[model samples]
Target: MKNLLYILVLGLFIYSCSSTKNRDFNKKEITANANDTVRIANDSLEYEIIVIEPGFNLFINSIAKPRGYHSQSYLENKNIFLVQEYNSRVNQPFNYNPNLYIQAINYDNFVDYGYEVNYMLYNYFVFFSREYNQRFSVPTRI
Candidate 1:
């Protein structure tokens, strides 16, 4: 009985130690991913966009087109269309997956958010669509 008790305690201790190591590794990974954010702030206009989705930074760097590939007007047009569709989905949770369309994006056509803002927004929409397997009414150009 004494030997069995010792073996059981030892096994529990080893199991706990291994689980703690895995938890520590996961914490470090989450911390690293927390830095993966895309932020664009227009202080003059008081307009800002912060994307906290994981893998977006990597997507933009590796998969997305280089900056200036699309003209500002082109980006704006694409963003406008995509935003409308996205917001529509957000509005109708019953129709669309609530998990996928969590919040509506406020995008005004009248506001000139500059090339960089539009560019990032457009790429973000593209990334979101691809990541979630959500398709827009109009086909998204890669």
Candidate 2:
């Protein structure tokens, strides 16, 4: 029982030490408004972002692009998705790769957008995937 207690304590200590968020987050007052944007820092990068504290339902109503913004062919094509594969063959257990792919978008295309437009678009797609499992591809085959 004593040995088990020591192991449990040691495991807890290790887990606490490994938590990056606990070490980096500052114990400071977070000031922001629901109708406004706020600045947040992680590591050393400071990002001026909006906090939409609602789920995807609200996100779809507020931030998502209209259905006709992208064509049906562009939405369904699989060739444009970039597959991110970085698993070690020898050290890690082998797993089947998903039919994942990504498209390289030109930033110049969105030149008229406001500052952080690219950042917002990036986040939008991320949430779109989590909420709807929707994927996108480049117009041209890579």
Candidate 3:
């Protein structure tokens, strides 16, 4: 009876450790997903929106725990010229106000990452004007 009890206890300890390790691994995977776009498990339940612009794809993925759903928005482009900083937390803390986060993306870097820039003629002119207003202003040297 003593030997049998010792074997049972050892088996339970091994099983418990294995289960705990699996749980820890799962948590790590979920935490890592925050960095990029993913088709979340139960993704249909998560809220997500993606916006595309000339330079990048803006992606916002948030989960409303109480509602058991997530929300996301994608705002592309470097049009947003403002910056703000905040503490980081789990489960999409940015949902409190996604616009600020959307504005943080560096669209130039997105282009550097091989994203194509498709500029209509008018858009090209407008972008150029903003980028080179001083040059455009100089008197032409005939």
The better candidate by TM-score, 1 or 3, is 1
lDDT score, candidate 3 = 0.31
Q: What lDDT would each prediction earn against the true structure?
A: 0.88, 0.42, 0.31
- What TM-score should be assigned to candidate 3? 0.20
TM-scores, all models, native as reference: 0.80, 0.24, 0.20
List residue ranges in candidate 3 displaced over 4 A. 15-82, 85-142
- Candidate maximizing TM-score: 1
Q: C-alpha displacement of 66 in model 2, angstroms?
A: 0.6
For candidate 1, the 10 contiguous residues with the lowest summed lDDT are 19-28
On residues 7-61, what C-alpha lDDT tens digit does candidate 2 reach at each position?
9999999988888655533333232233333233343333333434335335545
2 versus 3: better TM-score goes to: 2
RMSD of 3: 18.3
Tell me the spans in candidate 2 whose CA falls farther than 4 Å from its real position: 1-54, 78-125, 128-142
Ranking by lDDT: 1, 2, 3
Q: Which of candidates 1 and 2 reaches a greater TM-score? A: 1
